[model samples]
Target: MSPTNNKKAMCRYAGAQNQNVQRTALPEIIDRIVNSLDDPECFAHIGEEPIHFSTSVREMIEKFRNILFPGYFSDAKIDSVNVSYHMGQEITRLYDILSRQIIHVLRHDCLRYDRECSECERRGNEAAFCVIEQIPVLRQKLAADVRAAYDGDPAAKSHDEIIFSYPGLYAITVHRIANILHQRSIPKLPRIMSELAHSLTGIDIHPGATIGERFVIDHGTGIVIGETSVIGDNVRIYQNVTIGALSLPKDAGEKLRWAKRHPTIEDDVIIYSGATVLGGDTVIGARSVVGGNVWLTRSIPADTKIFMEEPRLIIKNQPKETDSEGN
Candidate 1:
């Protein structure tokens, strides 16, 4: 073939390749992807619909914390002089926000549709009013948490340090708030609050777990307290401790379903790091000390120290078999 004919064929081939490349270019693909953004609601709405409601609830938490701790949290300037005024303002604002968010969360998550009668809205409004009334109780619980942190951690300089610096205190604070909400039967808000704390502090405490006053958790990473797990007053636990379940429930078909399975920790019990107490039937008696890395399933008596000792091994030498009358 002639060089001119070959060159012409090559040019045609290059032009065809260029057209094909343009057909599937990055910009065109990006335009197709960008088309989904045209609907604002499609881009805006994701996850559960109550997320915005949850955000409002969290804002109330922030305001409550600001009011309770004053100088430790919130951007507002709080000193001895303006503390009362600032607290009052924050509390009032928090009450309003809490009423709205709590009602929304309760309607979306808790209130059984079957139980709703003609006076359902009135009952809900009354419940919301009761929740607002309970804010002082929540504040008292938070104060107790701060006191617990201060008493428990030697490294904590003051109550302010516990409020500002300790993640455990933060987690406990959230847990206390969630616990109150859970007790009020406010549904998904408590779990959401607990999960929010878990995400931030690495402490997964179920809101349904009944924890008494002065409960202290130190260096509280990877700590999990299961639902129905009752923690007594002045109970102290370290990092990497799990109070979980031993056995789950089985269905009629004998299929195991994840159910309430964690243990109950009695008062004055100190669980060291890496200790796991499993099963609802298992109980750690009062004033007992559970050592680090110990796995406990059974109930311990009061004032007992639970620990594991290293097992001793004895090596035995077996006698050699004699071949046909000691060869």
Candidate 2:
């Protein structure tokens, strides 16, 4: 064979081999392996719900705040002439949206054992409707919360400032909302509300915690008020305060189950920062003060002040005289 013919033949052979290699490897390389048996359900059924609903809840909270405090959070163009009308419209819309979302969450997440009985369903509907009807009362509670914030914070310029720019107010707002749902026994809504606040404010206040009016939480980060914790009126808690539990009830296999664990803070009390008041029986009495960085596990008396004092160290030397008379 001639040199030119041999070179052309070799070049064609190499091109053919490369084309065969690409064809064999491309399908396996780009193909996706989906486990059909693992997730046979749709994405909505298999995957968790989107967390954007929590963001929506936050937005709804902001809207409620704007409704409560006009011109502070909402558009500044609103004035006395049309403020009421605008607020009414906004509140109605918010109520509709919130009701639908809450109902959806309840139907999906909460176990509905009463749905079989007609009477139970009727009562549940009535209770849910009644709680939804209490938005005005919730608004009144929020007003009290704003008052509490203003009263507690020395640097607060006005009620408007507290309403517009306070994390305490935000946490209390979520608590009030969750408290209402909890009282209504609409499951899952309250936790969602509390957790939404937790994500935003770093304050985990269980909805089951019965908090009275005029409760203020100052610098609320790392503050945990557990379920069954009852906080009284005009109570103030600083950051890193934990109303927690000291013990747990274990099952037969020693697995810890949910139990009532937390403290109760009575009226007119002040719990300073980094204080831990634990145990279900630990009751902080009314008009008492708990100092910062104190760990309390016992109940305190009313009108008592508990604080930390520095410990004294003493060293004593035994007398060397009298043991050996001769020496």
Candidate 3:
């Protein structure tokens, strides 16, 4: 054979061997990944129907928002003439989504925790019904919150403006809904709802917190209300406020589960920006004013004003510059 033909034949043989190696390596890589799924802590739901987190759960939240604030969200035009009909459709849709998601979470929890089955389907439907029935009451409470926001913040033009534009109000609205499910002892769904709001609003309010009506959160960026915080009616809080537990150990989550690890704010209290009130025993009495940048770990009497002393201001004047022609 010619040298060129011999070289071509050798190249074709080498290429075929490389192709075989590539095909063999692909399955080995896949096998490694598949083997990792056998680990006890991998949490792989192999052969099980997976829970829908992003799609169905988020859509359910949107439906609740549409129902809670009629016409404020992306819903068909709602007016007094056809209000009942529109609400019926919205509630029906919300119930369908809510019940299904609840059942998924409940069933997943039962299987994961090795707990006995408790008729997740029936419980889910009942929970959905209870949440739907609370709509009227929730609306009334939200109205008070809107009114408080308008009355407290001079920048608010109208209730409509707050409903449409305010991130604080939106966060509070979602918290109210999630808190209901949290109170009812539903599994997983409440935290998902609250985390969704936290992601969007930068306001991390745990659904387990008990907040009252006429609550107002102004410039609500960086607000963190812990799980056991008890906020009273007519309370107003500003940005960067932390109503949370003190520092905890690594095992605190297990030890402090169901324990009151946050402060209590009595009615008509105002917590200003950058304030940190820590410890479960800490309480801010009724009508107390917590000034900005103040850190408190103790209980205060009613109508008290807690403020950090004015930061010392030192204004140093700069000497005037001289021209090259020495002025």
Candidate 4:
């Protein structure tokens, strides 16, 4: 070995050792910070020692994708001979993961509602089974969604490509699975699942939202479907659409907490890019076509087409100026 290289390596080792020695952190300050955090006034979890729900949510989503599209999404090489065995094994694993997570969440919820903690295991099992039992139905609904995408988008070459490549379908598939959990009243996990999809696709559909079959979102980025949004079958929405709340005064408070905040989009409606449909009472009627960049609030009649008038664009060439370097 070269002496120069050995000295360089020795210097790197000495620098690492120096950094470790320099990490003699202030114990007293850390203790004070810990004490401060332990105070109930400072931290909500201070008085409570709950069994926190911890699971591999990313892995859970992957498994969920596998379950939804058996051959396409699973880790294993699926064929007719091994398909049944793989599905059963994967489902069983998913069931266990969901059951554990559900119990953790249900226990916390029971405390909040002053319900019996004893029912956690049973309730969690029921909820998990409820969700699992509906996987076929969910797959059917997702198949409709995939079909919608394939039929609606001219860019899509095939249903297989749509399933494998489309972000909207991925988000919707996750939402469907999470929606089932949300419907069963299992908390936290649903939102977590949806948010995972949101992070992946930049399409935010709250799990609480009621979305029907054959729903499609084309160029789905910047789409926001709020908590109470109700969507019907064969509905197609484009990018930058917000089916969200019309804001209320701050003092409205918990009185209006459970009240619907988002719009009800009926069957066969088409909402285009950059359209903002706000308020619970604001209904985009069945078969209505809302054009791009339209701002709608009130209820529209069925078979109506709402769009903004095209504005004239006046183009003027700017005078060219030289830079400081006289380019």
For all candidates, the clash counts are 3, 0, 0, 0
Instruction: Write the residue-wise lDDT of candidate 2 on 1-327 in tens digits.
Output: 999999999999999999999999877665533344355473433343323367676776776667655577776578789877887787777776566656565555433332432343444456555655777788788888888888777898898887767787888887887787788677666788789889888999888898998888898899999888989888999999999877564642244234557788999999999999998889999999999999999999999999988568898998777656656
Pairs with backbone N, CA or C atoms under 3 Å apart (clashes), candidate 4:
none
State the lDDT of candidate 1 residue by residue for 1-327, as single tens digits: 799999999999999999989877978789877887677677533333344445665676687677656677777777889888987787778766766665665554433343443343454566556765776787787788778778777788888777787888888878877777777777577898888889889999999898988888899999999888999998999999999876543652244233446788999999999999998789899999999999998999999998878569899999989899796
What TM value does model 3 have? 0.89
Question: lDDT at 288 for candidate 1?
Answer: 99
lDDT by residue for model 4 (243-303), tens: 9988888877687778998899999999999999999899989999999999988999999
The TM-scores, one per candidate, come to: 0.73, 0.73, 0.89, 0.87
| Candidate 3 residue pairs that clash | none
Question: Which regions of candidate 4 fall more than 4 Å away from where they truly are?
Answer: 1-22, 39-41, 44-55, 111-115, 318-327
- lDDT of the structure predicted as candidate 2: 0.78
Candidates in order have lDDT scores of: 0.79, 0.78, 0.91, 0.88
Error of 2 at 206 (Å): 0.9
Error of 2 at 224 (Å): 0.6
